[model samples]
Target chain A: MHEASAATAPGRGGRDLAISVRDLVVGFGDTLVVRGLDLDVYRGEVLGFVGGSGTGKSVLTRTILGLERKRSGRIEVFGEDLDKASAADHARIERRMGVMFQQGALFSNLTVKQNIQVPMREHLRLSPRFADELAMLKLALVGLDLDAADKLPAQLSGGMIKRAALARALALDPELVFLDEPTSGLDPIGAADFDELIATLQKTLGLTVFMVTHDLDSIYAICDRVAALAEGKVIAAGPISTLLASDHPWVHAYFHGTRARRFQDVQ
Target chain B: MEIPDGPTFKSSRSRDAITFELAGRWTIGASAALEDGARAVFAEASKVRRAVLDLGAVAALDTAGAWLIDKTRRELAAAGVEARLERVRPEYGILLEEAHYRQFEAPSGKRRLYAAVLLADIGESVVSFGKDVLAGVSFLGEVVASLLGTIIAPLRFRAISLVFHIEQIGFRSVPIIGLINFLVGCIVAQQGIFQLQRFGASTFAVDLIGILVLRELGVLLTSIMIAGRSGSAVTAEIGSMKMREEIDALKVMGLRPVEVLIVPRILALVISLPLLTFIADMAALFGGLLVAWGYGGINPAAFMARLQSAIGENTFLVGIIKAPFMALVIGIIASMEGLAVAGSAESLGRRVTASVVKSIFMVIVLDGFFAVFFAGIRY
Candidate 1:
């Protein structure tokens, strides 16, 4: 495990960090959701966030994306302070980051091809034919055939929907990708396959993946480091093995439990 | 603080009736104070049948201050006393003319009648007719598209899903529509009986109930009920879906919310409404038949014969024709209100209420327009 950590050392040393969140805090009305959390996602490393329900993992991701305003914080994505960023700056940052939501979140009425072409249409100056070809490429990259591109979201099964959404997310060849609950609601075999896909894509594209998930198998299989959130704070963060070895009861229970043990056996 | 120089008035009969000059920025509150002062000054001037206010020295008097003096003068005139204004400022005089202050000088009885008629017309035409026509046309277009989309979709799975929505919106809605239609039939029959009995024409109550329920009340009542029930549900469903990011998901993937979700729901309602209204008409007639046989001592067979004679096929058709239009309005308005919902659960609640109230109000108003149109036709 330590050797694995050393082998995945931060990434290209001279390149800047992809995302930096320092002493971040977020609240909904009177209740604080995320509190004084710090994290650094270096360029070209898949950083995973894992926690129990209501641990503010999703809220932290939303804050970093500028979708949710932080109460007090500094969030610099590619050296830009997203906290105080203008709409144009936010647009610039968004152009560089791709997001795949849970449930695939595909539009029910549009064909998968149109869905994949959305970012390309918005951020790139490609002709319709060129955009169609690019969408086909993305669909193929996600292991989907071109026939799947013309189908609506409602036509696809759960696994296919997730893959279609991923194809759309990668439409812009984004530097950073945020995956929220990527393996949620999938059967174990399906989830494992998706984890493999994410790992394969990360390596081939040299993309940084910042994923928020509770799926332990996904964390173990794909993530270079795990950030565990609890009670609005980061209780543990670093290599997955370091988190598993921590004295914290939640950490021990999370990484050495029945689910984790089964996942390790599969690996 | 020295007051800016303006109008001055003096009552010759009273030493205490001291009127000060008026000048710049005399807004509503300042005018109110001036009126209070004038009223106080007049309290001691009972013997003085007339008083004159001179405005030659006034630079400007705001609209409210001018209105105050106008009102005071009218009150004095109503008591068979006289008050006059002399040398009023041109700008203030123009303001008074625009507000129609001179109308206060008219004979009280005539003014009262005119005001009553005008108020009634505004209530009927602007508030009722204008809002209904606008809401109805837009809703009609939306409902038609929605219903057609749902009914004609190629996918069997989607069509099956729509069956559940139909059962929820259509079949479950029948009981409420039936109950309301029955009550409406009984009320109309009862009212007809009371009015006709004065002329020993009680049996004609059957004819009236037959025509009213089959030709109008049944459709109107069903539409109102469904608009309240189904329209509000659509608004809340879409509004919550919007808040939950479901609608945003469609937009992110370049899908139109209207073409996808709204069209289907609207279509379902449009197709369901006429059918529901037909059921309501039958239910209402059943209620009327019970009333005729039990309370009015008319045989059920005899009542049916008279009802059939009085309500022609054209009458029934007219009511049925109005059903789809009413349904269209309800669906579109509800969906529009839902899509318009903002950031909170409270917005969902507000939009639901607005959808229901607006749909019901528009349905009744459109019913009146159809009535007028049919009545005006020479055929």
Candidate 2:
């Protein structure tokens, strides 16, 4: 854990910090969802963001992705402050990042292959044949059957939808990827396979993954760091060992819960 | 290093085969020229029994190049030509292999447009319509039973929902219905005056507008408008709720969605359509009276007197009588289509359209039945 932190220190690895959020406050009406939150996600590491249901983990992720308006905050991605970036610069930064929203959020109108090709077509000028071939390759990369390319999102199983969404997220060869509840609906084997794919892709593609999840097994198995969000703040941020030994009441209870204990047994 | 001439191909006919030399960067960046070249090659290859594509001189290749190569081979193979690629780069092999295996040939040549198939389709539609009618009748029975149950236990009735629907379907529709009926009434009066003036009996124009507006147009137009406007809205609202699984949620909570959602909406339509028709009748008569005074130079008093004698109490009652039935048809069809929505936006759209169309058709048909029945009774 110390070595991982050392590797991510400011002077190392040509912009080691991929995303740095500071003093962030997000709210809807009178309810404060994320408040006084400060977090950093290093480049080329998978950061698993965990929270109890309705703890605003997804909200915070959306705020960083520029989907949700923040009451007050400073969010920087790849050394460019999002608030100060111009529209063109913001679009450029956005093009370099990908997001796989929960429930896949696949365009119900498009086939799986067309869904993968959409971002590529928008961002890169390529012939239809190249786009088609690339879409097929991505389908293979995500472990979906080649024939699944022509199927609509409605025709796909829950696991296939997630894989297709992941394939789209990787289509642009993005440096940073945001995955919200990527493995929530999958069975154990499917979830583990998804986790392995993410890990392998992160290593091979050198992607910085900011994942929002409640899957303890995924956090334990693949995440390089885990950030626990509670009480409108990230109360603990470190490796799994650090979170397990934390004194924070919510963090301790979460890591020591029966479900966590079962997962811990196998680990 | 750029490919200055783009991708170029040189083809020549041998004794019984065509040998093509493919060169240059056959990639996406030079897609247009490469596509043209491929087209020319395929066109020339049709005359040969076999073709050899030599790629040894090709500068580079990617997935785009591989797709082109694979497409060319497939096209030739389809034309009964055995096409072979010589000196294929190892980098292009995996892509060509993958692309070749996942053939994009649509399930072909199986669609035969036979008269029997057309007949089968018509029969299928008839059977489907029968099922829909059965479903709608059963749903109407269910709603009636629930209405009776609610009457027995007044506390179980959703009075607020009933009021809201009444406001939505009835109150919101008053101005537009009034305007349309008023315009239609004026047109009818002006046309009657114009034709009757030729016969030196222009005073009889008032009779034409009065009987038509009171006996038929009032209820028919109002019902059609209501079916188009509020009926479509009802189907879309309920269909969306069904799509989002809210209907199932209502069921799990021990509430009958038909009673809670459908009954109130149908009751509102039934209660409002007759009132709207009555209002439309009055508006149409007023418009006709205005045209009679202005266009035909008849006094308002004379017009009112003519209208009074030409349209009897039963004439107005005849139109009002059909209003509730039309309302029931629209309400029943809309709710049936709404509840029938499957798990897609397309289905919701289709059901909404079918609801309005079926309701309007049935409304006009019901009006015809009422017309015949009233004439038989000498009303």
Candidate 3:
């Protein structure tokens, strides 16, 4: 419902934002990777975050997840300021969100079903039977067969690994999910199917999806909106059409680039 | 749904048709009663031609309840009884459908291995052991070549990383090594005193502690401790780097992983082992001195004089001389295991454990060889 450019004032749109980052500066030692960056992800929208390699897209996502410390900034999630929240409130906020890391970050020691059950067991108390059943349900929900439930992450193919990780992300039935390069390793068909799956899941569950990706097909096919990052700042944010018309140099080159041409207007 | 106090079932028979009415909670909290009731009803229901299970009165349902219903239906079907479950709420229907989809298979029996399989495993292990030995020899050659190169061009050495590793494996480990050696010294003196007192030679405990601490225990214990503590850490660090492809990344950047990472760590261990052994030796002697005087009634002067006579320069030199070789064994074994790590957490753990075990085993064997060689030369 809310559509705005990257330079637009924060909280100006009518619809609520799931994640709001302002003046976020993250650095390691003397080098600044993300400086004075601002990002907004509106509720129930799949926001595809695009950037060149080593442009700090993963760093920014990690900062939002509280994995990396920010030099200076304020981050808000679900209407609560992250910096000022108490420990309990922080945990509550964390419980409402799920993350599927790029490598799937699956617990190698656990079976796929057990991995899905981890979030369920950590945040809720239920009988082991019910937990296992729910884990199977989640596995099925992610389009994995029942046999995949008993297999370890090491035993899965790349696409299966992504699906299993997605299943684990949806285990707790969170309102928000963060996916990093979810389809990077998959084949074209697998990647397209995955994008379709994510779109369906987002629409059905009313999830606020924050996806960091490099796949042009993914941005064009499923993302309700796209934000472009360059030189430690978000230079553009809008729908695919808006990004195509942008005059910024990096945005122009990225969207109209040779590799991106095939995917442009495919949606 | 609130769980009923207990699950109970009532059954009625009308000639060929049998109806079993299930009531109360069938969730996990009342699982025992639910199982019993289901078993009792199903056992008799199988005798009937037509069996119907009514669940309309059930107050609560979970995976456990669905499992019970599923199991009963399965058992009845197995008995050739035409059974039907009715009055299921749609909310609970999904639970039942999911339960039906997830029917757990019985675990397969334990693996039964044939003689060929056993023999193949042994052969594989022997071949792997041979490969490990070859790899170790080659790795040592590479390290020595790198060391020689650094010696020829001293600026090529990574002094900062070397210092960091030295501080990690040596300086930070002093307190623990000192305490363990000191305690070993005290225990040896106490036991020697207790045994020698029978022969009225309680003061001879000084000679026992002196010879053992100076000649064997000091270097051996220090080597063992380092193998367990720093050896495992080295393997884990390098193994993790290998697992994450950082070593490959270094190779891509036109750097040899051995020269950058392995050389600094091994050099640190080799250089610091003797220094650590010296500290352990001193702490052990001090501890023995205290126990000798306090427990054996040997005055400090007498104990010191006896210590000087009981062990000669060669005794001290024998332990100190073995420190570098022991350090080399630990460093080489640890780094070799780390480099051999595959891409898995399990592999890293296995490699680390093997590094410690193999280094300690080889160190003790090397010590035995040293003992024999030293005796041959009468050192």
Candidate 4:
């Protein structure tokens, strides 16, 4: 597998990379947020991305999703160059990926079931029976109750919103899913349950997940490899053991910080 | 590489045992093929005593694909035919297990009859109208208490906010109000002259314009405009702030929202409306004077002389006196709707629309009441 960091990660050359970024630079006006960042996500592995509050972990994800413009760089998804692809090719590429925003981003007007069916209705043709069954299947996969299917996003609680958004993201059974702060607003128990859910879905679906999160427990629980962003580039990328072993100041502080110390004993 | 390969099942029967082998990409993309393959498998499986479904040649599978295959297997077994999956890869097995089929409860059926539903809706609206009046009265009480408290403690009053809102709702509205009233004044004068000229009384148009502009048209038009413009603005502003929990934040900060937010805005509305009414009256008179001179052969001197006798002090005061009550009604309705905003953006939008419509309706209704009162008093 092609691991993100060149130094610590063992590279198995033949394995497919789900997402590859080379010398990517993204900025807003004068402030560059992702400077010369290089990263790779192997297929069927959950890559946990870490950063400080303003370090622009989301900016990098948005750049790869083509929602935010990159100043310079190459981003390839499923071996197709995002910049060079035709509109139809880009759409085809997009259909293979799903994104869940931090705020749950479900259409407020649409019911939860309708939200899950949006991607399917847009890209595929299926009978109402199959469509309803699939939407129900997605909701079940996310551990949401069947009754939540009819309720609007505003009616849902924090954890339910996350689950509904995840169900919507998995609407097309996408190979790659981008989750931004998937467990942020959830309670401790809720966060653990969510992490377990992600882990289960990742294994069963063989999905390549790119999760941007500050939840250390989620990083430890579900992530196969963790990458840390500092100074607008990935400073370290490897297993938690490698991150703990790093001498880099930010890396040392992040994993060894007061709040992070709780996990050290557990590990 | 794009694999547009669709699903297919090859079936062969030997005596009573059937062997079915599924191949090609069994994914949601090939939705029709998945259904077709399932149908073909189920059709052949029921006739056999024993059935073997092979997935060894299946190129790809997702949750939807696994769902159809798993469901077909279970249904076949349910029909007294023993069917089992063969050569299922570990990932496909997990996916099949995850996407197992079960009955989902459909939405409840049978809505009420159309006629009964319409009657119920009408009943609900009438009751709601009564509740609305009660709510409006309660809101007026709260606002009055806040006003009294502010009056009692002069230091608690927000003078800066009052000034800012006065500028926002009053001064900024002058140009549009002036322009619309001027056009309306000219139209009324022209129409009056055109009709009265048949009786050799073209100059009588000046008296019509004077009475109409000073007593009814000027204040009514300005109030409606303010209801549409500033009333809607107030609702939208307060509704958004309430949505973001800013009102709650103020309450937690030991300040009354009605006193801080609504009082200043309503006070500004009350102070601005009469001034705007005055401006509207002057603009209408100016427009009438010009129209009489140019359109009806009555010079400005003749128009002014005729207007002085045509309208008394009561004509101007009657319109000016109604401005504050109209302003209060508009302000109360707008603030009430604004405070009613719930958690959703759709709720805020609905509240703003209701604020504008209700305030305009009430303004017109209130004006009709004022006309009757003034007529009874012989004003």
- Candidate that would win on TM-score: 4
**Per-model TM-score versus the true fold:** 0.47, 0.75, 0.66, 0.95
RMSD of 2: 7.0
TM-scores, chain A, per candidate: 0.91, 0.94, 0.95, 0.96
Q: Can you list the residue pairs that collide in candidate 1?
A: B139-B328, B146-B263, B146-B267, B147-B267
Candidate 4 residue lDDT tens string, A1-267: 254456535564467889988899999999999999988888999999999999989999999999999999999999888999999999988999999999999999999999999998888888888899999999999999999999999999999999999999999889999999999999999999999999999999989999999999999899999999999998888788888988999989989999899998877
* lDDT tens readout by residue for model 1, B232-337: 9999999999989899999999866776777667767888899999999988888888877777777888887888778788878888999988987798789888
Error of 1 at A214 (Å): 1.6
Residue pairs in steric clash, candidate 3?
A: none
List candidate 1 segments past 4 Å from native. A1-15, A262-267, B1-215, B218-379
CAPRI quality band, candidate 3: incorrect
Pairs clashing within candidate 2: none
Interface RMSD of each: 32.3, 5.8, 6.9, 1.1
- Model 1, chain B only, scores a TM-score of 0.61
Shift in Å, residue B1, candidate 2 = 21
TM-score of 3: 0.66
Docking class of 1: incorrect
lDDT of 4 by residue, B31-101 (tens): 56677778888988988889999999999999999999888888998999999899999989899999998
Shift in Å, residue B164, candidate 1: 21
Among the numbered candidates, top DockQ falls to 4
In model 2, what lDDT does residue A83 have? Answer: 90
Q: Spell out the clash pairs found in candidate 4.
A: none
Candidate 1: C-alpha lDDT: 0.74
